[model samples]
Target: MNTWRQTSPTGRALLVTVLLTGLTTFMFLPLLAVHLSSEGVPAGRVGFLVGLLAFCSQGFSLLCGLVVDRFGTRAVLASGFGLRIAGYALLGAGTASATAVAGIAAIGIGGSLLGLAVKTRLVAEDGVPARDMLALRSTFVNIGVIAGPALGALVYPLGFGWILAACILSHLLLAIRLTLRPA
Candidate 1:
């Protein structure tokens, strides 16, 4: 039962990370629907594809703690950013290929790593009480969750690629912030 608030710099980063993760999924949901719709993937398969992505992303989270321990947060975080970028691109291009599914998996995998990495970084930085950090972390994550669906609904009508592009920018912003901040 750890607790933290998005009032400090590290806390702000945590919020950003949660938002990135939430946005990543939110950005993909409708896009996936649209992408599949255009590809004639069959309406029935649409649910299956989205389910597959969620399943894979959730699975990745299960192993992220171990991965973060072995690789260090910096590497894991950077890779997470890179994966998101690549995942979105692959997904967007997946309009004509199977790579979109792979892209979703990649995003899921990166998200798991990012989730764990942020937690580890926060603890390492003494961001909050160990007893309440998890709750706080989840709170921010849920905020993203709440926002993502709305964002998807808003963007889904326009185009899925734009949502993916926005996600890329989010990652880039995190990367740049990480680079400029003293390690």
Candidate 2:
């Protein structure tokens, strides 16, 4: 809290965006297996898809660091948010299996990029202690971790498409907020 107060507006915005992204992504996770199973996707395939999603996210984090170095934070963040929006939109539309895989992959990649952008941006800023910034970031992440599954469970009765739509809307709002703010 004190660290956040001492941080710049950019830092604050980045933290908020990270929080929202984490919330949306985690919220979708618990619902994913159930949703896919209900859609008639085999359990083994569902497990594989989930594994693919994690693999892409972890693998792309390293790549996104290079992209951030080359293209700058704004570009990387915009691209990431764009991908997330598109991915969620596809899921919301109930696309075919291949398309669903592509969408999940996109979500994974976008999440990696967004995460890298936030960390890089935070580290680059002057006067903010890296440890404090990271701690604060982790706090926001924990909040999402705690909130998402509970929220998802609470909203489970609403249907899977609604969950996807919520994610899409969250990403869309973040992208718009990023665009309107200075890089």
Candidate 3:
């Protein structure tokens, strides 16, 4: 166990997790509306797709909380990012509604699991002073929420496909960061 007696693993993990969360948020939410719009999906349908992410993520969060202890953070993080990669690929291809929904659900599940793993590991490693870790993580998530939409808007001018590619790069970076640090 990497104790938090000296340099706080919780704080460090929180910082990294925040960045990862930002990347994750950037991966899906920001591009969702734009992606759907580009596909000529009805605005109402776009709204439903966006809403599905939150609903699906809620369920996934519950499941992730249950299994995170056994799976470990590394595995969860890797798998989550992998799902995001697949989700982006499917979205980029403009798959059928059923296929897109399945992919979105996968994204929600993977993202939630990754989040739980990060939180659990930070709590375990940081111990009592986990508040700072939690706060930092929350802040990062908020930042992601703010940045994602703005980033999404840029996709129109640059190219919709570029958004998917960028997300893939972000996920790769996230995986690298988690693997190198092992926390």
Candidate 4:
């Protein structure tokens, strides 16, 4: 129905942002385990690092909520994206165990704030039902879920540095565009 052309540019960007975020996230975040194991990191530490990512994404929501309330979605989204860009870079590039831990924490915290900011943007700005928006978002995520891993698999031999560079560049471009234009 030509809906793609009909939707506002900002709406399309929002959807596309989610899609890329999905792809970026799946591309290497999951590979932390493989990377750690190969590096001789103990299994227990690997589990803790992985688990820490999940815990921060959820555990820090209250703080994120407060941040959003104080700063507004645009600011929060920008900040979250900034954190994610740095976190992804650190996670992928850093060799030290301590650096990895810091990266994981950044990813988790950034993820929490990003999630909250996006949902809040959906509910507050789009007249569409949150359910519908969520469903659409999931569709993008599903595409990412399939493609992200495949892309990662293709790039694995080259190393995580390449993957992280792609991620950082993409996020940086998106952030600059979004911050300048807004939605």
For candidate 4, report its TM-score: 0.89
Count of clashing pairs, candidate 4? 0
Q: With candidate 2 superimposed using the best TM-score fit, by how many Å does residue 81's alpha carbon deviate from the native?
A: 0.4
Q: What is the TM-score of each candidate against the true structure?
A: 0.83, 0.95, 0.80, 0.89
| Per-residue lDDT of model 2, residues 80-162, tens digit only | 99888888877777747888898888888988988998898887767879999999999999999989888888777898877
Best by lDDT: 2
- Alpha-carbon shift of residue 127 in model 4 (angstroms): 4.6
Off by over 4 Å in 3: 1-14, 23-31, 180-183
Positional deviation of residue 73's Cα in model 3 after best superposition, in angstroms: 1.7
Ranked by TM-score, top first: 2, 4, 1, 3
RMSD of each: 3.0, 1.2, 3.8, 2.1
Q: Which portions of model 2 show Cα errors greater than 4 Å?
A: none
Tell me, by TM-score, which candidate is best. 2
The sequence of per-residue lDDT tens digits that candidate 1 reaches over residues 6-66 is: 3467566766677676766765665677678787878767776777778877888888888
Pitting candidate 1 against candidate 3, the one with the higher TM-score is 1
Q: Write the number of the candidate with greater lDDT, choosing between 2 and 3.
A: 2
lDDT of 2 at 169: 88
What is the clash count for each candidate, in the order shown? Answer: 7, 0, 0, 0
